[model samples]
Each structure stands twice: as C-alpha cells, then as structure tokens.
Target: MAAFSRTASLLCKNAVRSESLGKLNNFCTSARGSKSYQLVVVGSGAGGAAIAARFSSKLGKGKVAIIEPSDAHYNQAMWTLVGGGIVKLEDTYRPMASIIPSTCDWIKDRATTFKPDTCTVSTQGGEEIKYEYLVVAVGLQLRYEDIKGLTEGLEMDPMLVSNYSAKYVTRTINAIDKFKGGQAVFTLPNTPIKCPGAPQKIMYLAESKWKKNGVKKSSTITYNTAMGVMLGAPKYAEVLRGVCEKRGIQVNFKTNLVEVNPEKKEAVFMKLETGETYVQPYDFMHVTPPMSTPTELKSSPLVNAGGFLTVDKYTLQHSQYPNVFGIGDCTDVPTPKTAAAVASQCGIVAENLAAVMKGGTLTRKYDGYTACPLVTSYNTCIMAEFAFEGVPMETFPIDQGKERQSMYWVKLHILPRVYNLMTKGWWSGPAPVRKIFHLGLSKQE
Candidate 1:
C-alpha cells in the first residue's frame, strides 16, 4: 500500500509538468513571428505614457508594452512658451527610454493598424502584437499639406511661421523679433486642434513683446479664427475679448485661411458664413495649420463618424470592445484637447481598465475636466478650468476667470514639474487639491 501511494504521487507530478509544457508549446507555435503581453498601449504621448507607467507598476515587468515611434517624449504644452522664446525647445523633451517605465517593454515602432476584433496590433515593422487588453492614445496629426502652398510657405518664407510644429516654432520668435511694422496676421484652423487657445496665446505674447519694443504703435495685429466665439467658455471669453479690445487687436470671426502665397506674402481667407474670398498681405503671419485624427485611426473600425475613437465619454472605455480603452486628444471626449485634460483622464482610464481586466464593474468616471491657461501676456494669464458644456470648474477659491500674475507663475514654473510627475503616473491633475482648496465644496463626479 505504501509503494502504491508513492507511484500515484509521482504520476500526478508528471501529469502537471506535461500540461504546462504543452501549453508553452502551443503558445510558441501560435506566436511564431509575434509578441504578446497582458497590456499594450499605443502612442507614448501624455495619455499613453501615464497609463503605461500605471499598469507597468501594477502588472510587473514583461506584462506591459508601449508602442511608440519617436525617440523623444515632448512636453508639448511647453511649445507655447518655446514659441514665445520663454522656454528653449530642447528643454521640453526627454529621451523616450527615460520617460517610459523601466518595467514596460518599449516597441520602437509605429502602429500601422489596429485590429480590435482580433486582439492584435500590426506595426510598420511587419510584426504583430497581441494583447489581452489595449489602450489607444494615438494623438492628432497636423495636416499642413492639406492647405495649398502652406508647406512651401513654411520652408521658403522667413516671415511666415507657426507655433504648432517644433520645426517651425523657433521661427515664430525670429519672425516676431524681425517684425518692424505691418499687418501681423494670426490664423486659427477650422479643424479641432490640440490646444484651441494656443494660436491666441502666441498672439498675445507677440503683441506684448512688440509693445515692450515700441513696435506696437506701428504694427496692426489681427486674429482670424474660424470659431464663432473667442473661447468655448463664456466666462473666459468675455475676459479675453476685453483683453483684445484694450490692446486694439482686430478679431475676424467665422474666417478661415484657405491658401498662402509665399512669394507675394499674401494670405487668402474665406468667410465661412458667406463664402466670400479675400486677400490679405502681411509682413508677419502665424499659421495654425489644420489638424485631424491619424490616418490609421480614421480608417479603423473603432472610430465614430467624426473619425474619433468611439469611447464612452465618462468611462473612457471603447463602446464596442470592453477590453479596449482610449484617452487624450484621440478620443471622442467632448472637451478641449490640452495636457491638463489628459492628466485628469489618466486616473479614470487606469482604474476603469483595471476593473475591466478583473471582470468587475467600471466604477471610476471622467468628469470632462480640462484646463487651458490663456497666457494674456508675459506675466499674466487667465486660467480657464471647466467641465462639459462650459461649466466652470475652478480650482482656486478666488476667481480664475480674471487675468492674474499668480496663475502665470504657476503656468511657467509649477506646471512643467507637475507634467513630468504625471508622465510617471505620480500625479493625477489638481482634483484633490481643488477639493481641499474649495473646502470640499468643489464639484465631484
């Protein structure tokens, strides 16, 4: 009887080892030219990097993967300051390997196609990546080629510049410095952009610089925007409109920049309301080129009619696929596309995605909290914080709609440090601080 018991125990051990080996063999055969992970995050921007860091800490090494093509991760918010010559462009970015969590596998490749139904992502390098869960944070693409003569204008004309691209951002400061006196035109594209307030921010900064140099008396500044209002939020719009009026800056509403003549220094504008076309010659022009969702996303089945990810606005989960999620400017979240918005959405996406992985209910909800620091001058800013449908969501006890030097200090000094911490998943916006400052009276979703 003792011999029989020993043999039975040996057989049970062998059976367990055989089953494990068989499963390993099957996985190896199925994934011959592909890699697999528990979680895969696409794009290494604000949203992708933050969420990847969060899960990398939770799931441990080799369990998470981040797909990105760029070598550096840029703090794009600093580009505004860079364009204004307040911050160096080199100071805004870090090595991609340094910013990405050490535990997560970094696939240095662009995601060519997303096959949500098959639980796989094909890369430009001819490799397929399978993931148990996926996060799509691929941000917007700048379409400078969409406008005729715009691409050539950026390369050939020294007076024509844009704050939108790193390649052209430094040219903005150069153009501002070179301008003596003439019509200085700033344009806002008709498409949804990364930061809607940025075009105007640079305009204000350039105007302020000109005033300091006594160039303002001779120069005429014009803001030609396609939007019907100065800002989406009425409270902040009123303040911004007042700033423009006081500074004597002319604003043309419902106007779109259609074409540029680099040789003639001419800009063609179309009145969106009437289809009337007009030509305006400028000594200096800042073009915020039209932008759109990435081509890969536009062709994917995961997108809505507007070519944005079809995610539940509150939960940040993909509408059709429970295992898939989205964040930042790529999603159909009805809010301004700012880094602050991405920071607020990070925690919600991380929590809700974890719940989905565990086969549990998604308890966390995003409140559509987005903030845009409207830099009115070199030392003053109107910090506009709001929720969905233009509901004011102020963080400070005092009014945030007014232009304040204190807020400008925060934007220039504090926000950059906070942004670095956020990419590491250490910061999740100012919601808790807002609660404390507001003495628990702040709005909570």
Candidate 2:
C-alpha cells in the first residue's frame, strides 16, 4: 500500500516533466479555462496528425486543435525494424512540434474526461475545451500487468523482451544477437492488439537471424498464439502457414500466455480449448501483451460495448453522435490496426466531416483497405494488401501474396516516405497509386 502511494506520488511528480503524463500550464488563463474549436482531435498520432493537417489547412488557422501530451511523436511502425536491428531506435521519433501544424492549436495535455453528449472534455492540465466536432485517435494501451510476472520478466533479462514498448524494443535486438541456443519463444496474447501480424514477423526475423549465425539447429523456435488461426485474412493465413511449415517453426494455436517466471526462465500457457496449463522455458522471449483502449475512453460514453469508439465503419463517424468521429486503434473499425489502415481512414474522416460541417451529407466511404509488409526473412517479404473480407488488393502488378525481394524493398524504403507524406496531409493513402497500378480495376471492397 505504501509502495503504491509512493509510485503514484512519483508519477505525479514526473507528470510535470514528461508531456505524455501531464504538464500544468501556468502561462495562459484561457488554456486552463474553457476554450473552443471547430474541430478537436484527441491524439497526435498518425490519424490525428493527418486529420489536423488536412482539416486545419482547409478550415483555416485556429480552427483545429490537437489534444496530445507528447513532446516526441513516434513513427511506431519503425519499432519493428528497431527490434530486429534493421533500424536505430533514435531514428523513429521526431519532435511533436514538427508534425503538428502551426495553424492548429496543440493543447499539450492528456485528456482526462470525455463528454461526447455535450461536446466538451476536460484535460489533465485543467482545461475544459468544447468542440463542434471531435476525432478520437488515441490509440490502444498496452497491458503487461494482465499477465502475472510479465513486467518483471521483461525487466530482468535483455533476452526477455517485447517490441511493444520503446524501452523494451532495443532489448529484442540485443537478445537475438547474443542468443546462444535453446527454446526461443514468441507469443501473441489473447486480447486485441495493434499490428496483429507483428508477433510472427519477429519470429521469422529471429529464425532468419539464427540461420545466419549458424544457431538454427541449436535453437528450437516456437510461436504460440491465442487465435485458432495464424492470420485473420484467409489467403494470407494460408501463405503464412506454408512459411511456418517450410521454415520448420513449431506453432501452437489456441495457446495463450497466462504467466511468466523470469527466475525459472519459464512462461505459462493455458490451452483455450480444454482449460489445461503448460510451461515452456525459454532462452529468448518476445511477448505481445494484451492491449485495450485507454481507460478514460473505455469508460466514456464515446465507446461501444467493447470499449472501442462506436463509429460507422464506412463513414468513420460516431454511430450515436454525428459530430464525433474515430480513427486508428480506438475505433471499432473491424480491421487490423496498422499505420496503413489509419492513413486510409484519415481520407474518409476528413471528407465526411468536411461535408457535415458544410451542412452536406457524408459521402466518402472507407473500404477497410489495409496493408501489412510481412517480412519473411532478411531479404524477402509478402506485401499483403486487402479489404473487408480478406480479398487480396494488390498495389503492384505482380502477385502480392508471394514473397518477393521487391516487396521487402518497398517495406524497407517506400513506406517510410508514404508515412511522412500522410503526416503532412499530402498523402491520404495509396488509392491513386492503386488505381493506376490496377489500370482502373479497383473495386469498392
């Protein structure tokens, strides 16, 4: 009890220093009191930045306000490469001020209370702001504590790591590079998470790494996932299954991580089918913990039963409240959460919200288009693009399901450029490129 109180005190103290926690704004009386904007964005992530940049420009200066409490904005997708030693951790971030538009007012504080019915919200920095329209882009929150002993396991050893957190990502590179032998385990948790394919991506990278270091035979690689199937998309799942078979990677479906014992180098898994438990000792472990929407958003009226924003999947507008919209991991979009998905949704939200602002009808529709550059090895990747029902939507002329060096290069090179363009509202998605590549054969789905 005393420790918990001390920890809370420390958090309060540090909140003043780090923007993500909270910062007391003593400079402006208006900032602390009631203020208003034409559009208020709840996060400064990919979706929020894109919307703010696009709408703030079109609506004019001071019309849009982004409520974010982070000093440094991260291209979180790059954390995968950082985990695999393909990129440096430092290279993945930029000053939040750089991406947020000068025309848009950034609140620089964490939102504490959301009152969607009244179109008002209270921030941790003591600001009560009202908005004509609200965009909820505050992404999923990681929950390592959901699994007992998981945090300590990550803290104790470099090999005991995860790509989920910025602090733990570098350890993945370290652990993989220094791996000697024995059971190297990777796990996908039972709950909904950001980047569904990332767990296996790292597994494949580790397998490739082991083969290169001549430790392939010495190490027994295993992938344990809670889902009964590997990939959510059927066509892509089939190819991924084949990849696992070809690489001799042992996969246990319907297996979920329940606990960890870092002292024994052991992880406990419960079989979802029969309610049986088992233990596996590991030399290296990468855990993708359960993730959920932020507690504040989850408890708010903005969210649905599952604690995701109840937005129309097509128009990206709130189901009950027409003035509210959602994007990124927070929305109940029914698509895998990825930067590509978020970028594509930005276009839909911007167009529809603009139409509504002008007393116009919402016409722009999102087709659930999403892309995942599944890196199969050091030099190969399957650039899987699809829509609502696992229907393959290839951007290039060739087969997207097949592993290709060209696709790997696209993941390694082209996507970063696209992400940068999207941040500045210059790129909504690869819609135009897709149309041109498909020779005007693009379907709605």
Backbone clash count, each prediction separately:
0, 0
Ten-residue region with minimum lDDT total, candidate 1: 24-33
**How well does candidate 1 score on lDDT at residue 205?**
97
Which candidate leads in lDDT?
1
- lDDT of every predicted structure (CA atoms): 0.88, 0.85
lDDT of 1 by residue, 1-445 (tens): 5664354334433432453323322332233228998889999999999999999999999999999999988999989899999999999979999989999999999999987544678999998898767899999999999888999999999999998887899888988999998999999989999989999999999999999999999989999999998888898888889999999999999999999999999999999999999999999999999998899988897899989999999999888766679999999999999999999999999999888776578898888899999998999999999888878888888999998999999999999999999999988889999999988986664
Q: Pick the candidate with the highest TM-score.
A: 1
State residue 407's C-alpha deviation in candidate 1, in Å. Answer: 0.4
The root-mean-square deviation over C-alpha atoms between each candidate and the true structure, in angstroms, is: 8.1, 8.6
Q: Give the TM-score of candidate 1.
A: 0.92
Q: Give me candidate 2's TM-score against the actual structure.
A: 0.92
Once all C-alphas are superposed, what RMSD does model 2 give against the true structure?
8.6
Tens digits of per-residue lDDT for model 2 on 23-119? 2111111122278887899999899999999988998998889999999888888788889899888888889999999999999999999875345
Worst 10 residues of 2 by lDDT: 21-30
